[model samples]
Target: MQGIIDRQLDVLIYPEIGMDPMSVQLASLRLAPVQVATWGHPETTGLPTIDYYLSAEELEPPRAQENYTEQLITLPNLGCFYRPWGGEAIRLDLGKLGIDPRSPLLLCPGMPFKYARQHDWVFAEIARRLGRCQFVFFIPEVTNLAEALRRRLEAVFAQYGLNFDEYVIFIPWLNGPAFDGLLERADVFLDTIGFSGFNTAMQAVEQGSPIVTREGRFLRGRLASGILKRIGLQELIAGSEEDYISLAVKLIRDGEYRDRVRKRIETERHVLFEDMAPIRALENFLAKVAN
Candidate 1:
């Protein structure tokens, strides 16, 4: 660590840190004079030595800087350049998975840990309100925590008066092509609140599926929203839990509105993918810090 720091790196960024203990340990050390935290985890590292949290200006909400201990450096646009994984490919067959082709399908793709326990109520509420819809959940191969989450969600359904069979389908992770195929079949992609899904949202948008996102106070929470903004579809951005549920239900049920957003995503998506404003913002920040 000392050797790397000795080379005089003007900026060393810990892309994401909170989840990994080693990152926290390294963060405890003053490695770089202008060390920055970025969207890898998108939350505060709470390290005194870590100087800044670089995020998109539009991605964060008002007063978002208040959330972090370090000085906040909100970049305009995405704050980074990225590419969507995989490409146009064969989608998964819903029939093989026992999913009815006619049913409204909502895909929630994220790690089990990203799904907070309190979020079950939102799912339960959606089910109760929508009355009929299928939620596809991708669980990790290791069943311990994922299975526990399924059971807990089932309980939430019961508590919320959802008496439907197999309302939530728990399945194993799909490989890139198969996952893209499955994403093609979904009508609405529900983003995990708090810690948003950046790549998953991109994949879903690439598949031309409308997504429901709620902008969070933190940078992590606003990732998917930033992506959505890139595509020029703010109607899908939900401001509250009720708004999230309403937008999801609307996207699931209203074919016209859903198709409009899907069309926007398909036709205007290039604006979202290749913008270099963020790269410029980052470069400027590095230059300013170095000076």
Candidate 2:
């Protein structure tokens, strides 16, 4: 705090305050004349000292300011200049990875905690609807939590008279080409319901994989929906849980439709990467704030 004061900073752009205890404490104090929060953690700071919340046009819903303590500044598009992950996609043998190549793979690539219990039935329902489909999950750093999540989902699948082991598969985390290959191989990418994925969704779109997402109530849950909206693929964004399941099933069952969506993604996905509008908006916002 003393160092910040000594520097006489005009503004403080604090990100991911929820992810760090010390940062939250610092954010609660008036370290600068203007303090702004962003969607690194994608929730309201709820601190009196924070003057503004930096969000994107596509990420927010109607009258989204009601959900924040700070005044919301909805920037253009996804509000970030993102570079596509430049990795060589190397296809791996599914048999060696203990996955059956015959079964259609549905990628659910969010952290285990993001899989809320209420949405657990989604996987089981999709499996019931598509009897031969398999859902792939990544075991994030929190290994025990991932295992716990698997157990929880197994219970849900059992209720539907589906064997979780047969339909659900959890593999170690992958990066670079491995992750890209997985996305490419997946028949459909299922975005987490309550909290959406920004980077993962972007990568999936880059891979031209069909993604089914629920446009969440808040920014945290609306990222993939925003991406889909930006690319004019609103049909892939679901308004309700039932719709989400149906979209996932449709993608898996109708290969032609899935191919159509993938081709659409290949055509429209260029607008999403290397965007400059968000950066220009930030610059303009900063100048206005500084004055």
Candidate 3:
């Protein structure tokens, strides 16, 4: 703290304070006259020293201030300049990967911890509704966590009179082209409920795969929703758990609608990538606050 004080910085912008205990403790002190927090960990710091919570306008719902202890400052259009991801995906045959081309492939690539127990039923219900489909999950570094989640999901599937093993498949995590190839093969990208996937969702968009996400109450949950909204694909964002399931099913079952969605995404998704408005807004905010 004294080192920071000695430097006499103009302003201090801290991100992901919640991820580290020591960082949180340092943020509690008045290290800077203007200390602002951004959405590395997407929740309020709940510390009095945090003067502002910087979030995106599209990311926050109406009256979002109530969820934060610090004063809220919303930047425009996803709040960052993000370059579109483009790469050569190494072609891998789905059959060899144990994925059936005939079955609808719904990708759920979020970490196991992001899968809330209450939302586990959504997968089983989707499987039941579709009659035949495959839900793909990536096996995390810790294999035991995946097993734990698999056990819970199996219980949920049993209630619906379906075998979890029949509808779900877990594959080892892939990198670069391999992962991109998997994204391209996906029929629908299922954004995790309660906690959304920001970069993964963006990568899915880059592949032009349709996504279904529930706009969460907090910033952490609303990332994919904001991305969809910015790209004019708000139809893909759901308000409730049932809505999420229905949207996922529609993306899978409605061929024409799905094509139209893909076309629209290919055309409009450019708005999300290489945006400078948010950067300009951020610069202006910093200048205004520092002075």
Candidate 4:
């Protein structure tokens, strides 16, 4: 940027500005005449000349302005563009995974770092509310992190008077196809709090797996909510922590409601898969920024 940034470049976009020396130096340098940020970091860069912070309309909270310093540019009905990295969606038999065909399964899949301490109690409380239920969580990639999360959950469950060994099941991460298969069979997808999952939520929505989400004030926390909102599944999006618990429980207890939501999701899910409006919004933003 120090060498190439000049009057020739119309805009220089920083996808995410982490707390790193290089990003700070680059953002502080005003490398391009028009510098911008995006939803990657979900926070302000705080650099005076960093012109804009771009986010999708569906993913941003109403009071989003208070969270950022740059001029916020929101695009319509957009958040993530998901694609199959590898492997086709497979149909896995529950019997093979030691899962009973008749027992209900709740899938909680995400990174270890995204799992908050409070979430452990949430899971425990859910288990306490619904007896004779199984909560399945995907093992994190890192061995140590995976074990740490497992231990934390175990302790929390015990504290809540629920035996973790009897109620929780941990499945090691698998390839995309198999993972999708897991979603295909699961009853509900429990979203991560504070830091939501984008691609993971998309995959769950695509598979018609009912997800329970608590929308946050920040864009990062609203990633999955955007997907649910765009798909016309607002009923699945929880407004509060208690609402989240009720929604998840309802998805399990109310079979008819679950079926209605599942059917609606199956029919309305197409709209979220294809959206070209963001591209047009980008063109307009660039035209405006160029001037």
The 0-to-1 C-alpha lDDT of every candidate, in the order given, reads: 0.82, 0.92, 0.92, 0.82
Q: Encode model 2's per-residue lDDT on 51-84: one tens digit a residue.
A: 9999999999999999999999988999999999
Query: Candidate 4: worst 10 consecutive residues by lDDT?
Result: 79-88
Report RMSD (Å) for each prediction in the order shown: 1.8, 0.9, 1.3, 2.4
Candidate 1 clashing pairs, residues 3+ apart or interchain: 16-41, 91-181, 92-181
Instruction: Output candidate 2 Cα RMSD.
Output: 0.9
Candidate 3 accuracy as TM-score = 0.96
Model 3 residue 195 lDDT? Answer: 99
- The C-alpha stretches of model 2 lying farther than 4 A from their native spots are none
Per-model tally of clashing residue pairs: 3, 0, 0, 0
Select the stronger candidate by TM-score from 1 and 4: 1
Q: What TM-score fits each model?
A: 0.93, 0.98, 0.96, 0.91
lDDT of 3 by residue, 158-208 (tens): 999998888999988988789889988889999999999999999998888
Model 2 residue 146 lDDT score: 93
RMSD of 3: 1.3
